[model samples]
Target: MNKKIHLKVNTDLNATGEVLSWFEQINQPPLSDKKIWWQCQTLLIEGFANIVEHAHKNLPLETPIELEVLRLNEYIEIRIWSFGQAFDLQQQLQTKPELTDNFQERGRGLKIMDSIAEELNYLPIDAHRHCLFLKIKY
Candidate 1:
């Protein structure tokens, strides 16, 4: 089995900052490289933001989301697992969302994540659980 470092936090935006801080702490160079660091940070913050805004929006703050970061053979894997609503990333992408000039925002975050991460996926193993996996090559 691979050795993994696990961190769990409340479903709050503050937790996002905490997660980034954890990355900075353990990383060899402490997430100092601008391009690499921001890429990782953006993907994570967006995913975490999704959890906060969509998944746990109705749930009480005490309900936690589990974050697992593993340094595998050649890549780093970040898994955000929650016992919340089931979401499909592919289906979301296929959605033809209507956009207008005044819309201010649209499907930008997911697109950004898709572009940066080596692999980004949503796995709905069952009705009550959803896992978002974002992997980055080191």
Candidate 2:
């Protein structure tokens, strides 16, 4: 059996909670491995937060961010689409930022996502539309 879910959220930070709730609801039952589940959750949160904080930083809060999830037997795929300046995830990964002593703020989300996701891809659909795809294996 295959499962799919789609969510369109405002760019506001508060919308993260709603997006996460939808993620959890669809990732139940047949997808019962807790460790993998948490990894997916973390990736989802980090990815969305990245978009809100960096990608659409200058855009209006009313801007819509689209998220899609597809669950197959062996792996789950998540795609996030937003209107922003195009970014290259691969190039970002090539340069690792230094982690300072004060850990309260700045950096780390992308590193965690890179480690957890089996496959991660970023593409610019157009001048304004960019998409990030992540696949996690169960």
Candidate 3:
């Protein structure tokens, strides 16, 4: 496994910058293919946004979200822990969205994450503890 990088941020826009910096800090240089880089950026941004907007729904104003990245064998694992209302990704998946109806603007975040990451998991320990795991091949 390569060196792992971790970052934690408050429920604010600043988290976006932190995630972007992580991509640059990787040992490998940026990919020559803009498409791959763009997809990576999108996944990171959406993943962070989901944590802030969805997982941390009842987070205290003073507490920040905790995020950790683990570089494991053949994959990068991103774990986001939150001290807010817990939720289940499986529930979200069960309620399949209606693609033809474009009125509601919900449930898209997880969908996007599913697209980029090879695996995605949402676990809830209790009403106030939640964790999201996203894994992508490196």
Candidate 4:
């Protein structure tokens, strides 16, 4: 059977933990695989951190970010939305910086997410809302 989960949270540092907890709640026995679960969890945290760091960087503390997960028979889709500012994720994807050293502390989130996601796209829900969509096959 197909299932869906929805979460709405502030664009704060705490959102990362909330996202992880939500993921754990949905990752049940028989369906649980460590690698797949970690991939999804990582993507979710990266997406949340991106919005918190970039989109809401100068915005109000109460700004909201929305996350939705849809589970299908063969794959799962995650949609993340924010109303802070418009960002060109596609452009960012194309210009990923080279990671030469393990000590490099920046520019790896997008690349990692891109590698794991089967499909990734950015959609402007409206003039104010921006959405990042990611699909991963199990």
> Which predicted model would earn the best lDDT?
2
Q: In model 1, which residue pairs have backbone atoms overlapping below 3 Å? A: none
Position 74, candidate 3: lDDT = 64
Top-down lDDT ranking: 2, 4, 1, 3
Q: Write the per-residue lDDT of candidate 2 for residues 10-67, one digit (tens) a residue.
A: 9988987899889976676746778898899998998898889989999999999999
Q: Write the per-residue lDDT of candidate 4 for residues 1-138, one digit (tens) a residue.
A: 478899988879876777888876556543566788778888888878887888788888788888998888777788989777787787987777644432468668788888899988778999888888888887
Which candidate model has the greater TM-score, 3 or 4?
4
| 51-128 per-residue lDDT for model 3 (tens digits) | 777766566555676777765556667777777766667787557564444356766777777768888887775766
The model with the greatest TM-score is 2
Worst 10 residues of 4 by lDDT: 98-107
Q: Please identify model 2 stretches exceeding 4 Å from their true place.
A: 98-104
User: Candidates ranked by TM-score, best first?
Assistant: 2, 4, 1, 3
lDDT of 2: 0.86
Select the stronger candidate by TM-score from 1 and 3: 1
lDDT for each residue of candidate 1 in 6-120, tens digit (9 for 90 to 100): 7788888877768888766445544446787678778878888888878888988888888887765556678888777776787775563433322446356666677789999
Q: Which ten residues in a row have the lowest lDDT in candidate 2?
A: 96-105
Better of 2 and 3 by TM-score: 2
Candidate 4 error regions (>4 Å) = 29-32, 99-103
